[model samples]
Target chain A: MSAVGSLVAGSLAFMAPLAPAAIGGLATEYVGALNIALEGLILVGAFSYAAAGSIAGPIVGFAAALLSSAIVAAGADLFSRKAKADPFVVGLGVNMLAPAAASILSQAVFDTKGVAVVAGLQSAMALPGLRYSDVASFAVAAAIIAAIAATPFGTRSRAAGMSRDSLAMAGVDYGRVRGAAYFVSGLACGATGAALAASVGAWVPNMSAGRGWIALVAVYLGGKRLGGTVAAVAMFSLLLSAAAAAQAVVELPAELLLSIPYFTAALVVIVGARGSARRSARRRAP
Target chain B: MRPGFRTRFHIETIHDAGGTKAAVRLVAALASAATLAALAAAFLSSEPSSALRAFFLAPFGTEAAFLSTLELAAPLAVCALGVIVSFRAGHYSLGGEGQAYAGSFAAALAAPVLYEALGPASVPLSILIGASAGALVAAPSAIGKRLAGADVLLTSILVSQGVIFAVDWAIGGPFRDRSSNLVAMEALPRGALLPRLAPPSTLTAASIVALAACLAAAFYFDRTRSGAAHDLYGRNQRFAELQGFDVARLSWAPIIAAGVLHGAAGAMMALGARGTAIRGMSGGIGWSAIGAALVAGSRPQALPFAAVLFAWLDSGSRQASILSDLPPDAGQAIKAVVILAVSARPAIAALRRRR
Candidate 1:
């Protein structure tokens, strides 16, 4: 493959893990909350899918991932809606809890500390040299975008997120709508984790590795628009790909080089923050 | 108290997910979580009887096991103290993992050089340096939150991950001890290690420091004027500013203090027990500490016991794994459940108002 071709391939591969969560998070974002448990949800999904897939099959793995993630995602709503817990706190707690759960589960089931291997997970399909998982994530993103654009569920979710009082006045149960959105959001992130494990063909502890957070960053950089979010993910992936490609020639330490994407995230936040500030200042001046 | 102040205090107190309801919730949640864990073990373990014995009584089974549990709790308690400071100040810094890691690395790196010059006096100085490193790592996020309105949650975690990646690389690549088989650097000199409680038990003087830190943190938040001011600012920043408090200072101080305590904890793990910066040595302590802080409801008085409880759970699980056919992660599951339960407080009063 050409250098550019390889970069594109790398970008797609890296972007797959993030795309589902970003797109799904947009649903929650529309419903006036961000699914903070993206990391934990992803982790749970990856482990469930990997463990189940290895034992049964990939289909079973995927189903297990979806169900587990949805349950965790719904916990946010249950706590926030009925019990009135803060989403962020609940999310933080889940993030901490999920990995420990995964670690313990792996140790118990597989007797592994940080990794468990699954055979036959390697992609048997490829399109134009793109990894199958990458392509599948793209398809999932497209389907989600389509659902949001065409479905009543999408409209209600968006409405619930944007303005609760107005949504309530319109005779819709905004909380219920939001609770449903989080479930969907959970599935999307869960799938992302599963896809990530499938890409590696193993359930490695800490494998999600902040990809969920990156998905959130993509959502921010994309202006919360679907296309922009995908594009932002592509951009970040390009940086990662370029960093990977550079390692053969670059004299810098691998750790320093590995920090490229995070530095980009910090950079994106700074740039995004400043732009919003400028826009707000202009609005105030008027 | 007047109705107005009482209401405002209610608002602030509930934000940290601890209070009257929390105490009740803590017991209820803990009971259910523990029960669930026991049930899982009864079903899951190959040797249920041995697992039960290890899980419940092994930590107190012997002197070494008991002291080892305290040794583990010491760093965790300090880390929780770090977490409570920031959470109480209304700033969430999830960078405790990185802060602790950085502290360990910094102390490990600085100890030998300092030891050569200062003799035994270098131990405390190295630990101080280690703590400063953690505080430094946290500074950007703290400053960003104060000055730029950046999301401290994201920024702190981002900075922390970046540091961990860098440090992990450094320990593996640049600092790789050609002499050792394990992926770790040189061990601290005998003088550099924290004085042990006794032989065959790894408990050290660092446990006392951790205790002192919890007491001080509790006293600071509960007794001092600055602590009160900090709480007011955390509960309501605009209200604090309106009432003539220095909101900006309050905003950053908790984060810095948290960084220090977290760093100290990391330093403790290195200087007190490990004797060197082992690969991923500070792993999970940050997350465990956050859960521990929640269990304590950000109260210093309750922190030690909470830390010990977490240590007990962890050590017990390790014992179960060692003595019986039990999974090592079982303890982690229980800890997660407990943390979730502890942090599940909702602003019920606010909900009632809306309704």
Candidate 2:
């Protein structure tokens, strides 16, 4: 394959983990409760995968990841709603809790808090430059996105965010809709985490890194539109892959190289916000 | 003008989130934290009672431990003051981590050279340099918020994370002390470091500074006309605008001021006891400061006590790790629970209905 072809393929594989998270976040975004705990959920999923995969197998790892992340995410949502807490604060709390829980579990189960290699993961499934998990994650994300865009349930969920009272008056439970959204968000983020760890065959501390945050950013950068979010995620993945490619050719600090995508996202968000502000101002002018 | 400030900004003012309600929530949060600490000890340790005892009592066990707790609380108190400032001004700036880190690195880098030229005067000067670096990092978010209507929370975190990575590279790659085994910058001159308040305690004048800052902040917010304007601006920007206040300046000034405070706190971490800029030193301080600020109900006068409480939990967790082999992150779990609990608002209607 040509270098360009390889780069595109690699970027798609990179998207395997991130795409699910961004798509999942999109669900919560429509429900008017952004899941700031995407980061934590991803970590929970990855740690669960690492632990379970090393013992049972990759399939079991994925199943455990899905179940654990869903539980945590759903539990946090229920707690926030019942306690009448700000979901955003609850999300940040989850972010802190996830890593601590991961570390504690690692120490308890694996007797190490640094890294736990998932043996036999490498031999489980492989494609030219991708793993089966990568394709599976992509398919899952696409299905969720399609469901969200086309389903009547999706419309009600979106309405729940935009006008909760309207939905409540319409006899739909806003809390229930949001609760369901959070569950789906958890499941997708779990898949994201599992794929990320399975790709590397090890559970490194903070293995999810900031991918969850990136996914959240993608939700906003895509203008909160389904197509735009997908495009945004793709763009970020491509930039990451390009940076990885550039490292072989340029003598740059790896940290600096790794920071480029975040820097670009920040710049884009700022500029986009500014342009929208100006446009709104123009529209309001006599 | 563009909908009421309540609808448009949606930044929770201290008035909305704090006071007696905050106090009740705080007590509940602390109790939950203790319960969590106990559970974690029970699950993680061979000797659960010992672990629980170490976690609950060790921070107050010895004079050294007490002083260390105070020392940890100082910077936290300072950072919480910063968090309170932005939060009160209705800007949820989440860039404290980056701001503090940039400040620490800047102070560490400036300390040695400044000490060579100015002797003891270098300490404050380096701190000032650190504050400037923090302000530089935060300016983009503030400006973006003012000019572009950008969300301060998102922009601040994005800018901060990027700065953190860049700073990490600088600390680990170029500025790293080759002779040292740690990923950190060279130590500041001993003269440049803060003078310890008590011998062998590692406690410095930072505690005094923190106390002074809290007092001054309390005075400024409660006893002054400008502070009233700032508070009003936070609670209802539209009303403040109608009252002839400069809403434009108020929108962004508090965030910059917060950057200054966060930077100072970061500088204190380097100059107080560490005397060096260590990679990841600013890791949990930002989040913990937010927790401390919330526990204080965003009230400056209450920040010192809240900071000490958090510091005690931190110290006790460390002690537990040493005494009973409890994982140190158990402290973090307790803190997370506290933050979540304190932020909760149990429905008055529901409570009355239950009654």
DockQ of each: 0.39, 0.50
Q: What is candidate 2's DockQ?
A: 0.50
Estimate, for each residue in A71-135, the C-alpha lDDT of model 1 and write its tens digit.
Answer: 88987678766765556656777887789778867876777776788788655558664667657
User: Can you write out model 2's per-residue Cα lDDT over A89-193, one digit (the tens) per residue?
Assistant: 788789988998899899877889888876775424556667888877777788788778889879988889789999989999988998889998999999999
lDDT of 2 by residue, B223-265 (tens): 8988888888878888999999889998889889999999999
- Where model 1 places Cα greater than 4 Å from the true spot, the runs are A107-114, B1-33, B344-355
lDDT of 2 at A116: 80
**Model 2 alpha-carbon drift over 4 Å, by segment:** A122-128, B1-19, B347-355
Among residues 3 or more apart in sequence or in different chains, the pairs in candidate 2 whose N, CA or C atoms overlap within 3 Å are: none
Interface RMSD of 1: 9.0
- Candidate 2 chain A: minimum summed lDDT over ten consecutive residues — where? A120-129
